[model samples]
Target chain A: MNNKKKIMEDLIHGIFLILGLITVGCVFLITVYLIISGVPAIRKIGIINFLFGTKWASTAQDPKYGILPFILTSIYGTAGAIILGVPVGFFTAVYLSKVAPSKMRQIVSFIVNMLAGIPSVVYGLVGMMVLVPGIRKLFNIPDGASLFAAIIVLSIMILPSIISVSMTALDAVPRDYEDASLALGANEIETYFRVSVPAARSGIAAAVVLGVGRAIGEAMAVMMVSGNAAKMPSLFQSVRFLTTAVASEMSYSAGLQRQALFSIALVLFLFIMLINATLNFFMKKGDVH
Target chain B: MKRSLYKGAMKTLMYISVGITCILAFSLIGYVLYRGIPGLSISFLTQKPSYLKGTIGILPDILNTLYVIIASLLIVLPLGVGAAVYLTEYASNKKIVGIIEYAAETLSGIPSIIYGLVGMLFFCQFLGFRTSLIAGALTLVIMNLPTIMRTTEESLKTVPNSYREGAFGLGAGKWRVIRTVVLPGCVDGVVTGCILTVGRIIGESAALLFTAGFAHSVHGFIDGLSSSGSTLTVALYVYAKEQGEFQVAFSIATILLILAFIINLAAVGVSNYYRKKRTV
Candidate 1:
């Protein structure tokens, strides 16, 4: 009986070890695969031009790979989203963290979690149906789906994440700062921006970086709205993101062309790695308490 | 008076944004309910997606999704728990565990779309799996592994050391104590992780795009494995794009969202039950 038990325990232990190794191995293989396929494409495209060029076309013969245009659209969309989303989201966090009555805060907090739970594709669906038409009729953009649409949808999608994190950060601010400022006779808004905001700057910065990461890697939602144009992005004009570039074309694309699409994936992976790492670093740095 | 006016303006902006957010949620739900419910007669979910497009139903797509989740969970759940057991129970070195923890965290940050690319190269073309349900299922297992491992680890850690010591007093082996005591205590947590894993897989699109192709409907276990299957989310996207039939897209979106919302509530319900059980 003891011998049988011993065998079972050994089997379980081996199982645990194997599972751990597979998790490690998957991450290891993905990095290796990205680098292996990416290096040659990077060499061919040249680092500087690939980052700076504006058009992407890969065909039977010659291929042109310039990600600058897509990179530009990603930046502009993220920036626009931040501009639109941050003030609202940050204030919403403030409402939840500091200002709202307890009942309201509890309800709002749950709602925020629900929003966070929503799939990004649903966000894209709402954007297409509601935001797209609103932009067209309200703003009168020629195309309903544009960088503008992507920005609006991305901002909303990112809001719950930003608010949830920023709220925690704000909550972490020593209560003494608010109490002291109020004791010295400052208004709520005044104390918040002057004292509380400064204290939570690092945390808020982390939130913004997270939002940027969300924007850059956002594919399906943005893909549905961004119009997938390979050209330079205008707010009203359509654009393509590096993440969407491959997903949009992967179906029909073949040959070296397929390899070229994989190359696009390589570029996107590297870009996300840089952003995601920086976000992690800042999040850790913000962990003062 | 001016200050009051300013306050009013700010209140308006606040209400508008919140209202819009609410409307966005409701509008999608409303549209989907309006179109899909009317369309989801028994016939719709029972038959294959007709290439005839507008008249196609998602019976096979639904079944394939169920198959993918079942297969993927079977592969992921035990392995995931084991990894968690080792990390939380066996490993004492904080630094070594920290590396794996951080790697898992970073992996979660990588977009699902990138996971699709890796799956394409590793599972589909390289391994010669072709675009099948298994291909998508395996990819999702990878996509969800980190989350499951982390959640399970947290659950295991929540099991008090007193239980282990009690078993030790009885001359039970370490592994026996873990299997008998800790595993039962952490069952709810493991279940939460699995439920969440299902949520992630069910709603995922980009990862499934290449691995699972975009057929409106496919049926049969063998056909689902060998043929094209589009998930609820992908179907929403396809209908929203090519069809522009907002009614159909809305209906599908409603189904996906409500399904997600329900599963989430189920996870929370489980967590609450566990919390209560633990207190007792």
Candidate 2:
């Protein structure tokens, strides 16, 4: 009976250990699969032309599989969103974490959670109808769907992440730091900006990186608002992102077209991995402080 | 004078920022509800679309969404909770813990569209699941694993060491201590994780688009798993984008919005209840 009990315990431990390792297994599986499938097309297309080519006419009789347009558009769009979203999110985080009364903070935080919970598709729908048309009328453009509209929608989508993450970081700032700043003759506003914000800088940096990840990885919303044209990115032009590039062509694509889409996905995966490393670095630094 | 000016400008900027956020949130919710609610009706929820009848419905989509949610949660809950339990209760090596935690973070950071692509490659083509609800559910199981593990691990940390020590002192085996004391204690975390997972599953579309092709035929759970179907979000995308049926899309969006609202509320309520229970 004692031997049976010990064996059962050992078996259960083995099972739990397997379960614990499943996430690692999954990451390995994805990386291997992406590389296996994504490498062939790149080998055929040549790395420089595939990554740096400025045109993407995959379906034409003579296809040009240049993805420079998508790459530049993704970079420009994410940068624009960060520029538009971070300050508002930062100020809002400061307000919520340090300035707002408790009840007000609770209400606002709930609203922020609601914002986060809203589906990306719904945001796409709203942007397509409202922001797209508004842009057209305001800017007197021929078409409403442009990189600018995508940037606006992305900025809104990333706000919840930036605000919530920054709030957590700001809230984690030691109360003693703020008290000392106040004791040294700093006012409340100055103390929060100088002391609390600086103390939570790493965390805030992580939050920004998180926002960057979300914006760059986004597909459906950006696809809808950004006009899905394979053009070099200008603020007012219809442009494609690396994400939308993969999504828009996947349905009816065949042969090299389909393989190239997989290659685009491979590029996106690499970008996300880079961002994830940066986020981890910031978070680790935050923990150290 | 300069200090006062700086203070006033900073305070003003903060208020303006708060104002912008609130306006964005209210307008989004208000606009979705305003446009979506007017198109919702009993038949729209109860029936599926018929090309012959010149009518549209989302009954099949609703059922598909339910099926995907149930299947993904059923598979993911065990894997996630088990992993969390091992990390918290069993793992002695800090390096292993760090690796697993890093993997979980990487998983969460990955975008859903890539999951869609990989899921298509792995489950649909490689594994021969085809474009079906089961494949989508499996893909989502991967997507939500980190969320469940993180929440469960957090609550497991709150389960005091003394409870486990006391159970061990009673001559209970390791598994028995966990089964009796640890698992039961983290019900709130599991519940919160479930709610969040449901919300994510509901919101998910890009990942499911290819892994589960957008077909609207209704079937029982067993059949549904193997057949192609669109969840509510995918159906919304199809209607709005492919079909130009904004009215139908709006109605589905309303249902999704209401569902999202409830899930968010439930998450907050469950966490608050657990926090109070622990204190008391």
Over B108-218, each residue of candidate 1 has an lDDT whose tens digit, in order, gives 878888888888788888999888778888889888989789888888888889989999899998788887998887777788898888888887888988887777554
Residue-level lDDT of model 2, residues A1-289, one tens digit each, is 9999999999999999999999999999999999988889999999999999988899889988898999899999999999999999999999999999999999999999998999999999999989999999999999999999999999999999999999999999999999999999999999999999999999999999999999999999998899999989999989999999999989999999999999999999999999999999999999998
lDDT of 1: 0.78
Task: Estimate, for each residue in A1-289, the C-alpha lDDT of model 1 and write its tens digit.
Answer: 9899889878877777677667777888888887776677667768786778777766525577787888788889989998988878877776577767888886676667667666778888778777777788887777788899999889888887788888888989999999999899876666776788788888888888888878778899999888888988898888988888888888888655666677777778878788878888887788764
lDDT, candidate 2, B1-280, per-residue tens: 9999999999999999999999999998899889999988899999989999999989999999999999999999999999999999999999999999999999999999999999999999999999999999999999999999999999999999999999999999999999999999888889999999999999999999999999999899999999999999999899988888888888888999899889988988998998889899
**What is the fnat of model 2 with respect to the true interface contacts?**
0.84
What would the DockQ be for model 1? 0.45
**Could you tell me the lDDT of residue B21 within candidate 1?**
51
Q: Which candidate has the top score in TM-score?
A: 2
- After superposing candidate 1 on the true structure, give the runs of residues whose Cα lies further than 4 Å from its correct spot: A1-14, A60-62, A139-141, A171-202, B1-40, B51-54, B216-223, B243-245
Candidate 2: where is the Cα deviation over 4 Å? Answer: none
Worst 10 residues of 1 chain B by lDDT: B20-29
Clashing pairs in 2: none
lDDT of 1 at A57: 68
- Chain B of candidate 1 versus the native chain B: what TM-score? 0.87
